[model samples]
Target: MSELITIIASLIALLSALYARWTWSEAQKANKISRLNMLLALKQHYSELMLKEHEKARAWGKDDSYAEACRNSYADYQIKYRETSKELENFHARIVADNI
Candidate 1:
């Protein structure tokens, strides 16, 4: 009877270990997904804010001695604004696709 009880205890311990392993694996996978979501959100937000700032900069031109420099600076902001807007759109599309 004592030997039988020991065998049962051993089996129970093995099952418990397996259960713990499965739970841990699931939790690790969830953590990775959560981290990816956070990174995506951060990227989207940062890019959007940068685009907004660039737009504002173009609206409010800098005071410069050289007219050519002023036009060049405004042109730079215009280019960055368009690029950032495109990037944000691409990222937004990706996030929507990921959700689907």
Candidate 2:
């Protein structure tokens, strides 16, 4: 009876280990998916901002107050877009490294 109890305990331990491993793997997969989604969102946001900045630039000139404001806003958006792009590149590199 003692031997049987020991065997059962061992089996239970093995099952628990497997369950933990599976759970960990699933969590990793979820994290990867979440990161990918964030990357996509950042890209989309940067693209939209860039397009709007371009539109503002094209409509710029005339030395009017509104034009000046638009230009300033465009410059700010340009800086932000560049920073976001750099972040996206770094994130992509990290994800690639993780896969390797």
Best by TM-score: 2
Q: Looking at candidate 2, what is the lDDT of residue 29?
A: 74
Q: Which stretches of candidate 1 lie over 4 Å from their true place?
A: 61-100
Write candidate 1's Cα lDDT for 1-100 as tens digits.
9999999999999999999999998886676567556656655665566566556656667654454454566566566656656666675576567663
Q: lDDT for model 1, on a 0 to 1 scale?
A: 0.66
In TM-score terms, candidate 1 sits at: 0.58
TM-score of every candidate: 0.58, 0.75
Compared with the true structure, what per-residue lDDT tens digits does model 2 show for residues 63-83? 677777777787777887787
Clashes of 2: 0
The weakest ten consecutive residues by lDDT in model 2 span 53-62
Q: Pick the candidate with the highest lDDT.
A: 2
lDDT of each prediction vs. the true structure? 0.66, 0.80
lDDT of 2: 0.80
